[model samples]
Each structure stands twice: as structure tokens, then as C-alpha cells.
Target: MTDVAVPPPAPTTQTRARAEVAVAGVRVAPPVRRQAGAGPSDDGHVRLDGRGAALPLDPSSPFEVVDGRLLRDGDDVGLEVEAVDRPRFYDLATADGVPYEQLARLHGTDVLASTVIQTCIRYGEDDRCRFCAIESSLRAGATTRVKTPPQLAEVAEAAVRLDGVRQVVLTTGTTATPDRGARYLARCVAAIRRAVPGLPVQVQCEPPDDLAVLSELSMVGATSIGIHVESLDDEVRRRWMPGKAHVPLDDYWRAWDAAVRTFGRNQVSTYLLVGLGEDPDELVAGASELVARGVYPFVVPFRPLVGTLAADHPAPDPAVLAEVTERVAAVLRAAGMRGADQGAGCAACGACSVLSTAGG
Candidate 1:
């Protein structure tokens, strides 16, 4: 857990190979050998084949891509681009006219993630999380309004069989219930596990009113759970997630404690996003507290994804991200935790966080 400073260097072949393995993209991690080409532009972006071009490493730039790759000064540097080809399961449909792919989308090589309920109770501008585009994909008709348990089972089975998917992540928009959206997620988990026995699945939702729902999720074969409290600061929570902020921080702590007791240490985690105007020290301190509580803090940079309120907003500087990542990594290492060891959830896959590079 000792902090060790490693000097930053240009991307090496080994580092590139590891990055390709982590991202699981065809352009970046092709099974067959392929040429890696780079072309410089006047604006400092470098074009890579199927993979998107790189951006400057400056943390102040609002421009960023879905892949967690960082860009600095036009040179690719630490960024690695990988193109993920469409999975075969996307072409199939259920008996009831539901497209199988809508049930879940492929993330990397082994992860299947779904927004189980496309509808959100807090979709309004006043209450919605600035970073969320929960219903945008649904409005665009890219996903079904709601995925039936049977429909999810069909797609999960197909994804595991055809695409070699090894884990599943089920997230839902908050609903008006004591259990929040955990009940529906439990049902989905049970159905998917029934269809594909032994497939590790993670369920994510707001902290529910009933802590016992954690046990229900565990009993239903959910290997992990994510109760995302994007920030610990009350003001930051209020500004970024007005609806969720109404639920006190005490509620999150109670839920996280219950989940850890039910799912075991390292099985419970939360998303602590950077770039929400919270002090970097607060993030590190909050993450350290979560570690002490046996909760893995999934530190991800705040990307202003398209279709969200923050779309026009700028992201934190890459240097800031790197700094926060190094600090959180120390905490995670001290707690004997690593994202890959979680078995499921975003932390386990870690494409969204640079902390994984520091061995979080």
C-alpha cells in the first residue's frame, strides 16, 4: 500500500498490450496482428483506425470519448484505442418481438450491461443526475422501454454462448419504492442465472429504503451490487443529483453496510465520480472512508456524455484525474481490494476509471 511514484513515459509495447487486453477492442486488441497507425492533426488530435482519435492530456478539455483513454498534446501517449465489433447476439430477437441486444449491450469482451428499466423516476432536468442519459437510448429506440425477465434470459443466454460474455451488469432508473429498483433487478438476475447458470451478475440501483433487499439480491444469485453515491459532499450531491440528494448520506451508509454484510467485503461498491466541483482532497478522504467501511470506491472521471445535462460542460483535467486516481489507488491497495477481484460491476471491468492502472 506504500505510495510509489512512477514517472510518466510514452506508451510502450507492453503497456499497449495490457491496454488492449483491458479494453478488449478489435482495433486495439485484435486477435490477428494489425498495424497501429497514427496521424497528427493541427488541432492536436491523432487519428487511429476504427478507434477514435486521441485528445490532448490537459484536464481542462471538455472533449473526451466513451473509452477511458486519455489524450495529451496530440500525441497518443497513455491512450489506447480499441474498436469493439458488434456482437452476433445483436441480430437476434425474442419471440415477443423484443430485440435480444436491447436487453443488454456488450462492454469489452466479457461484460454485458443493461439499463434494466429504461424509464427513470427522476428524468426531469431538476432532479436528474447531470451525467445520466438513462432514457436517451430508449427515446432513440435503441432499447426497449422495459425488458421482461424472459426477454432478458433469452438475450443473456445468447450473449454468453455467442460472444463469450462472462459477467452481467443490471442497472435501473430509480423507481418509487422502498426497495427502489432492487426487486425488478432481483427478478432479472434470477431469470438470467436460470438461463445461464454460473454467470456472475451485478445489480446497480439507488440505496433502497429496505436494507434487507441486499440479502434478496444475494439470494437471487447476484454476485455483486453497486449503490452509486456519486459524491459524498452534500452540496455536490444536491447540485449534481438533486433527486438522489434528498436521500440522506446516512441512507447510503446504512445500505452499503447492509450490502457488505450480505454480499461480503469487496462485493459492495459505489461510484465516486470526479469533476463535480468537489475538492480533490474530499474525494480522496471519502474514498478512504469507503475503503475502511469495506466498500470499494469506483473512482471514475465525469465525462459529459452526449444527451446528458453535462454534455456541454467540460470534464476534469487529465492531470486531475491522474492525481485522484493515484490517491484512490493507494486506499484500495491498502484495503486489499482490486477492481478485477470484485467479480462483477464497473469496478471489476474498470474501463471507465484510470485507477485500475495504479492497481485499484
Candidate 2:
């Protein structure tokens, strides 16, 4: 894979600049400050979502230990963790013996996200995506096995009412059905909207075998959609997400086109992780292609979170990430697309990607 080095920008006059940067697609306050020198140690730590302390990851932390850096693009921007108080609904339980937290988690200050189905068809060791920890929380008794539609609706209502959640994100584990879990997500979206009308919601799933599933999601009040084709390189797909690789890149393109048609241009997006050994030039080129198609290519760094196969792997060099982000940001800028403009989804949430900091 070829590496493209981006020349560092000229130093700003101020020691600190307050900017709204997106992570996973949500805009948050980032205090961009000038560093005296360049190195991993020079990359200071900040809280994830602005609620926690700026604790450096211990060498033994469950998060991936990549040259002593935490995954999820820690160096790209500074975070001001918003103190998200636990919602009052968390103390209540559904009639069917489920906890609200099991269905959805509060993201940043206002977004609610759920792994609608906790088990993935490709979750076995031989086939699972190395970067996914989808079932780890379930196995550890941290979440319920599967969340019912009613359960999601009930929780969504409570989150919005109690915690002032403004948007919802529904993602599912790939199911055996031909829709590959889009059906479940659509149902969840419908139920949530019915419970709380006009709530902007986003649904994430593997590209369904039937493109019509996207329309179903849109009709159910899914204002945005994420068809995550984590990487564009076939070899990287095979190495990182073996089970998903069988689906073919053509299917993903078709799905993206159909999603844009149904949801409109920037309303459709895909997650493009920057590490994974894909050539940086190819990654940028692939992002440009997606932008041309009117699909937002959300470029994020690969985070080797705890319990995932890649936890011990190293993140891409921070300099490499800065280069990739700047390049992709240029493409998004040309398209007049910003993550916050999407209204909802990971791009709208903006905790995972630094491209938002670059004005993507």
C-alpha cells in the first residue's frame, strides 16, 4: 500500500482554536491547539465525548494498544466530554424482562444507538470481522440477547423524554434473512417513530440483498442511512471482514446508489476506516468516487477496541491519519457536504472520525 504524506499546515497564530469537529458524525467542541513538536507523546489525550478524564491509556487497558495510543482517532481533535446523566428510564424495566440500557446507549449528549440484534451471523472466530466486538457486550451480560421492536420503541421514548435525546441510530447484526437485518432495523425505526413522531433517526446495516429495504427504512422515518463498506480494497475486506467479503463490492455500490435515490445525496453514507493496510492513495480515490456518486464517504480510523480481534494491532501513524483526513475532507468540501448536514448517523454523531474536524 502506498503512503501519501500530507505536508503539515502552517502554524496558526493562536495557541488554541475553538472548533466544532465531528466524530462518528456528531459535532462537538474541540480545542485545537498548536503542539510544539510532532510525536505520539506530543499527541495529548482528551475525554471520549467530553465527560471523562483525560487519562492516558495504560499499557494494559482493554482498548487496543497501538504504540501506546488508544484507538478511535484520539489525536485528531480534543474532546470536551459532555456530562450525560443517566436517564430516569434506566431505572425502569420492560414487561418482558429487559433493561432499557440493553436496547440503546446514549451517545455524546443527544444520540441514542442500539445494536437492534445483538448476535451477528458472522460472529464466529473464523468469519467475524476482526474489528467488531458486537457480541462481546452481550456475552458479558452487559446487554440483552435481542431487542424487540416494542422494547426499542419504549426505550427510545424514554430516552427522548428523560434525557432529551434528539436522534436515534439503529444498527443490527447481519441476520440470515435476505435483507441482512434491514427488516429488523426498519421495524425498529417504525416503532420508534410511532412512539415519538418526527424524531430524526438513522439506520445502519449491511447492504441488503433487496435494495427496496432502503425505501422501507426511509418510509419508517429513517432520515439517514449507513451502509458501511468499511474498506474499498478487496484484499483488505477479505483480511479484515472475512464473512462480509463474500457479499462483493458491487453489491455495496448498488446499495449505495439505491440508498441515495431513496434517501437523497448526502443522506446516504458509508464508513471507510483509514487503517486496515489499504493504500492511502486508493482510500482517498475511493472516497472521491463515493462523493461523486453523492454518497458521503465517512472516513474513520480503525479503533481496536477491547475484545476485538485487532486489539493488539497498532493504529496507523497519526501523521498518516492527518493526511488521509485532509484529503477526504477536500473531497467532501468540494461536494458541499458536511457530516452535521446529514442530520443523523455516525457521521452526524462525529465521535469516531476526525474528518469532521477538517470540515468534512
Q: Which of the numbered candidates is closest to the native, going by highest lDDT?
A: 1
lDDT of 2 at 292: 84
Query: lDDT tens string, model 1, 1-360?
Result: 222333333443433432332222222222212111100000112223222222223334332333545333333445445444567888898887777766677654567778788888888879988777777777777777788788888888998889888899998888988888899999999999999999999999989888888889999999999999999999999998898899999999999999999998998999988788998877788888888888999886675555677766765765666667777787788779988899788788765565666667
lDDT of each candidate versus the true structure:
0.71, 0.70
Model 2 lDDT per residue over 1-360, tens place:
224333434322110111112112222212321111100111112334332211222343323213322333444333333333556767768887777766677654577778888889998898888878777777777787788888988998888888788888888888999999998888889999999999899998888988888888888789999999889999999999999999889999999999999999999889898779998888888888888888898876664456777777776655667677777887788779888898798788665566655767
State the TM-score for model 1: 0.81
RMSD of 1: 7.7
Best by TM-score: 1
Q: How close is each model in CA RMSD to the real structure? A: 7.7, 8.0
* Counted clashes in each candidate structure: 6, 20
lDDT of 1: 0.71
Ten contiguous residues with the weakest lDDT in model 1: 34-43
Q: Which pairs of residues collide in model 1?
A: 56-71, 56-72, 57-71, 57-72, 59-317, 59-318
